[model samples]
Target: MTAHAPPPHAAPNAASERTERWWHRATGYQVYPRSFADSNGDGMGDIPGITSKLGHLSDLGIGFIWLSPVYASPMIDNGYDIADYRNIAPEFGTLDDMDHLIAEARERGIGIVMDLVVNHSSSLHHWFQAARASRDCAQHDYYIWRDPAPDGGPPDDARAAFGGPAWTYCEEVGQYYFHFFSPAQPDLNWQNPALRAEIYDMMRWWLDRGIAGFRMDVISLIGKDVDARIYEEGPDLHPFLQEMHREVLAGRDVLTIGESWSVSIETGLLYCGRDRDELDMVFEFSHIREGWHPELGKFAPKPFDLVAFKRALFSWQDLTRDDGWHALFLSNHDLPRQVSFYADDRAHRRPAAKTLATVLHLLKGTPFVYQGEEIGMTNARFERIDQYRDLETLNHFEEQIAQGVSPEAFLAGANRNSRDHSRTPMQWNAAPHGGFTTGTPWIQANPNFGEVNVEQDMVHSESVFAHYRRLIALRKESDLVTFGHTVQLMQDDPDIIAFERRLGDERLFVIANFTAQDRERELPQGLAGQADCLVWSHTPRGEIPRSLRLVPYESLAWKL
Candidate 1:
């Protein structure tokens, strides 16, 4: 699969014709602050370190950075448990550093999107502390609390997402508080008007600081009805979202992306529908979940089924075709590396990474590049559970081991799906600690950084980073790539993932081989012809042949 000598079409001037939002044609890059880079020899990445690395992101041509949480915390859940919303974590630097990072990133046309973890606050947060100390305080009503059951146990047998019971007893208050995640993180009571007002005010404060927007953490659980065990997309969800929009997001030219683990195609539009005014997009997990064991969940691994994965992915594309927008991503701070999880990381790492990026970036949505993903990072195949740092992974290890699961068996699963795979220090160069820190890293860097670092990839001809740079540039210049409607092809083909992007008469066809073996796929009659080559992974060709033979992990895009 290749292209002819026909020159690519002139860059489209569609911005003047359409009232497009800044993000519609932009690409997002997520920065897990703790693992990105370390300055001051602290062994932990900070805002100053992130500021120093802006040139790398600028070179990649990202429009925004979805920075993971760096708020004041006790280091539980890797900063997801927020202790203070308005301040920065001491380990991550100060508020001045954050302001500087925003200013510096803005100078390079990259907006910094902060992580909003309003669904819960750290147990150490002042509000939570006050709430737990006294049931008579105003803050007591700011969190979900209920009386103990007749048997003096929890209000219900609900389980936390990390592990153990969801309800934690507050002896001082003589009641139990609900937490969807770890007990160290207490659920916020969105039903309380005062609590809502405080959240709105905090959001306004951040927006006033000139940050881009927010990538909301577990937003679907905000309107949970704990009494009924309805934690996801509850009845009050939209109303609360609508209220939040009215208060904080309505007139602001900022992007808001809600993260929903349970958002399905059936209820997709409710969050990002054109008229909904709730969120610009959602980080839904239907496609990612398809790779997990059904009943056993993420810990227990399952074989990657390409067909089912396509169905889940393309379904969202279909759902957002004419209505809501999509948030394109494969890896994140909470997920395993894309090359290791989705494709052949060991043998075909570079091409497979490029192929994955090709399929995702060409889709009609704002694509996100996780830190180190552009360089084809692999999983931290830790042999022991102690090598892991994620609370979710560590807690699950204990639970599974206690349930008669062997330590070796649990370690195998953790190696495949642990969040720490993506949390390892970013591979910057071949230097010690992957050049991420001057001191010992808080988490051990992937040992393969010597072979798969950004500096190394930038010099290679077949570079994943280079491929991503081209894709990002293509989105910014090509109107067809930005607004074209997606039409999935070869949905049933297990070895091939193909799709067409059509905007009026302009068409961009993309195809990728998802296997380690050579694959011969019959191109659709309408798609076979001489065309300008948009991008290719393995070899550049002269034309789109009727019978296309793709090398292992080869990907190509043709604009016709």
Candidate 2:
């Protein structure tokens, strides 16, 4: 295995370099602030709680902690609906509490990354409020606004991301504004040069505050159609991103990762390509859509496409091989837990979680450990459809109902694919609210707490927690997992996922059984070398099962 040499030059600014360079040789852990830790005892997670946990989090060998969102909002879209880019919500604590978290995290060597909600802003934001007040307001141009059709209404072709028409009628302004998500999240008008400069100023302010970088939200939606029609990116979007490139990011050291969900490899490169100098990388979610029916198209889970997955993964690796970087993740605040979607959840959650972790932690790119993934959290079971709090879930459910789908059938699908699966509070203990808060929670905790809480796993050394610690430790110890080239091995093996990472002469192979079946894979000759199963999330007892037999939900990584 041969390790690629570090880039010829480090990032320009000390702070920018701190965000991107720090990660090149370090580990990152993501926190969905609302469910990470609760300090105010208000049945919600807050800044103080996160600050208090810094020592333990930093001790995990993580170098960066990317917070989802702590911005002020009405909680309509959770914190993604940012009311103010500079202020921390009072519920989560004040700006000082945030400062404390940053200072303390820095003291513990955990750099902070903001969940930059650049694509949209909450309807309550001062800018939006002014826009809603009247078209005469200075902020009227801050968000996308359009005149009603000749028929005196919005265009029927535009569809909201959650469902229904994308244009929301504003009686005050007597016009329709575009929203890719909930109506409360109005898309920002990036075509407005003044607006773009304002957004850039916000970015610079955060960087000047000793923060590391950002996780840009809905990046694909940043630059949109400038003509009468909107909600889709146009040729202007690319050149628009270039404008951002020249003004904001160019040679900065801070890491800029975009959540450009459906972007193709070419589009992704254009957004993060070497010459464009837009972002450090962009997320590709095509493979994440595996296991269901896209024909029905409402966050459906399609079947796993190993070949497609390989091609996509390698495309990202190859495209950015010597140019940019890629941000990897299995789950975040917007999707279902990986263990629930990838592994067997019928009876055994442990093996499935560990096996999933083994595959994710050893992948080629930077591994993003969601708040509870390290402890093996599963999806929450919603008892009633109305009980679902996520706006995305509710909107989709309403859409399915309007489509003439039966309520029961629509909810049945929702149970399997709703974004609510990941919003349930983190399961910390058997106590009420999973020890997340001492009061009534802002949201319900998962009912599986008795079987799946941190306290229980901490006591069992062979628990998923132990496996994750070792997995993270291994990643820290090896440069291959960080920057070496990744190559899949025995990729077509039914129910098995195997990949290799080689740096210099050191080569490591990782294999996992994605199903509950015994499977054996014969390495295609070239990989036959002196190999030892250095780490197995679920390797069997004493004999070391050298023939490559995979148990139900077992995963093994070999050093060759």
Candidate 3:
């Protein structure tokens, strides 16, 4: 098979040539507040807890923190269902606490990127309450609503993402309201000019309070046409995004990333093209979904396919080489732990974690490290269904059990792929409850925390945290790592992932053995030469020989 040639980099415009954004060279770290740290001995993690850990984040050499929602909420979907866009949840802390975090992190050269959840609001939100109470109020149009069907049922049988019908009847207003996820989250009506203005004003509010930017939650769904059943990349998507850019983002030197599960390679640039003025990048799931069962979805995962996964990932590399940008990551709060789900999390966990980090961080994009990821944290092995705190997992358990899926069988799938796996308390040390709290933890800590906590990893020479720090430092110091054109090699090799990054005469080659077995491959003529070792998981190497052999889960990168 012919090797795929690297796409040529687009010529930088006058503006881009003179200046580069901070995010261009810096890596991001995600902090899930409720699991990060506990300040007041509360079972739940709060904003102050995150502040206390700023030193740890700074030590990791991250540029920013993509903070998950700490907004006022009832915790229905873990802060996704916002009751007040401008306030913080009492359990989390106050607005003063949030400002302090932004200030403190900025002092350490870290920006706090807040989560923007505008697609929906909690049923308890004042606007939702007013809309449900009376049809005469202006807030009534703030949400999507429809008259009942002739048969006095929901307008249609559209089911919610969580479970049951998407339409919920509000007896006070005598109309049915639409929700994409749960009835508790009423979909916002973007078609309303006043509602759009409110969202823009709210975004500006956060920006003025000294935030870095926003990681928009399900932003693709904002311009959804519920009446036509067009949710993702609908007709108004680009227009709304452009308007948002012009209204609140044009002058700011901040980064914006949109989260889209339905975005595909064909429409990738529409959301983040340099000229589109929509966003800085997007959190796409095409590569992550490669391991999911086609018919059964994430719950019933298929075996890992390295070839298909490479195709999905490399396509984005090619697409963004000339336009737009990529958001590189393998794990997040919504998915299972990378080491547990994608690689060996048992005996070879450390090496496997390093290999995964090597492949993702070396890619051409902004890399984000999820909390505990740098320490190679594995998934939570919950024996019972009640142990899960995620509404998505619990709701699915109920639906699957009713459909004749045995409790044992569903539990097995949940164990393999559950959001709660990533939501467990961040293991800081070997103390009780993993040093996450002094009281009972909101969720059970992973039993292996004693061996995988950050305190232990930092002291070890070959720890995953050290590997991540080196990778982050390399990106900041090497232009080739930040802007080189990527050329993926060994496309058909199922056991090894190899790629070469080229910028002018400089080249950086990276290779990783993804399996827990010895593997060998012949290097291409262009890749065989003396070079400086940039990063490695096992033994360090000084040159790329014609024939290369890698031990189990070994990874190496060299600059040529």
Candidate 4:
């Protein structure tokens, strides 16, 4: 295959020239702190637990670890509702523990990325408490607050991202406060320069403390409408982001990723464009949310149309080829496990897991591996609704039930798509609690842990963990895989996804079967029998066969 030229506007970061900025070729892993491990027999995972697992990360060949929030929180929404931005939650450990983690991770050549939840703060936060005390207080404007409507109802009819009304009346203050999530998570007022400064200062403090960078939570929501009459996309968001880049991220050689919900390709460029000077990259959810129905919510599962999925994926890839960057991931703390959600978990779990990994990791962007994803972990399979511990799941259940959805039906939906499916404790071994904790676990471990634990996979040559390790190593060795432009192929086939990455003389092709049935297809004339197999999920990794045949959930990568 002939090499494709770089995009007309392509301008990769000059900072990428720095040897220390290995993120260009590195794979990042996300660890949900509470579910990663438990070292003190305290039921909850802590910094110490993560420290002990550095060896595992090193073995996996991950370049960085993105930790979910461990800040002091009321535990209202796991840890997203932060009560204090600077200190570690007592349950997790102290500031010293965090410092130790940073030092230890750096020793293993892995950077620690903190989760920044600056969009909102817990209602119990000092700023929120003070704001609620009186309108004359200095912190009054720290959070978004407005007088009740003429009828003493909410400030406006805006809806919360989670559910219900976005405005909550605080009887003590005789006013309503805006929140995109739960009432306990009062939205911060970015309009207040003081609040923005405080947020930047907190971020700098962490970066100065030997930490790598930040994975901003709901960052797009920070710049919302002045009155917040609607849920999103405010007028002043771009200017605020640009100012933040100038004040906080300009000279630092660190990564900055934002969780950009419902963002379009054009808008995404404003955040991560080569010259935008905002975030280093942004996470877009359009492709992943393809299976979701707006009225039914994510809980009510829906099948994704392969053509639609490819359209969204290719659009982002084509648009960002030159201007911006993307964050590639299949699942995270808020989504269901990829194996069960995107692939066949019942009949072809192993191959499906590896196939999914092949499709995502080879994409032209930074790849993220969620906890347990490398070990072929499936859903928690919680039979009773009470077994789930996630606040989103519980709140969603109540909301659905109130909306006339039958309890059994709602629980089934939760079973298929609950955020809790990805929140179960990491399966480290076959021992009780999956060797995650000695005491009662904060949440139940997946029963399949006995067969899917890391211990078993570490010794198996063709295990899911081994496949991921090889993929990471390959990424490090191939510049084409890391920085090449993508050209999708075979778009008409519903059960197959194929794409090529080309850069000069180097060309790489990735193909996957998204179903359980075996299928065969004629190779693209230019690629037919000319490419050598670089990696394969269920086939020999040597050379591409003359006849192309793919088994259930099989995937392969080839280099020409």
TM-score of each: 0.97, 0.91, 0.97, 0.95
Clash pairs detected, candidate 1: 3-541, 3-542, 4-542
Question: How much is 228 displaced in model 4, in angstroms?
Answer: 5.8
- Candidate 2, backbone clash total: 12
TM-score-wise, the better of 1 and 2 is: 1
In candidate 3 the C-alpha lDDT for residue 321 amounts to 79
Worst 10 residues of 4 by lDDT: 1-10
Write down the RMSD of all candidates, one decimal each.
4.6, 4.3, 4.7, 4.3
Q: Is candidate 1 or candidate 4 better by TM-score?
A: 1
User: For candidate 4, lDDT tens digit of each residue in 1-560?
Assistant: 00111112222433233232457777899999999988899899999999999999999998889999999999999999999999999989999999999988887888898999988999999999999999889798999888998998987788776778889998878999998899999999999999999998998889888777899888888878846354455777789889999999887778889997857876888888877888888888888778787678788777867787888888888886765777999899989899998888877988899999998889888899999999988987778889988777888888888989998888877887889988999999999989999999998888888888999878876699989988998877777887788999998789899999987778898889998899898878687665688878987656666568899999999998
Model 2: lDDT equals 0.75
- lDDT of candidate 2 over 264-329, digit per residue (tens): 765766776666667767767766665557678645556556566656556666665556667777
lDDT of 1 by residue, 1-560 (tens): 00101123432434223246788877999999999999888899999999999999999998999999999999788899999999999999999999899888888888889999999999999999999989889999999999999999998999999999999998897899999999999999999999999999999999989888999999999989988889999999999999999999987778899999999989999999888889999999999999899899998979999999999999998898877889999999889999999999898999999999999999988999999998899997987777888999989988998899999988888888999999999999999989999899999999898998999999998888999999999998888998888999999999999999988789998999999999998888887889988899987877899999999999999998
Q: Please give the TM-score that candidate 4 achieves against the real structure.
A: 0.95
lDDT accuracy of residue 539 in candidate 3? 85
Error of 3 at 142 (Å): 0.6
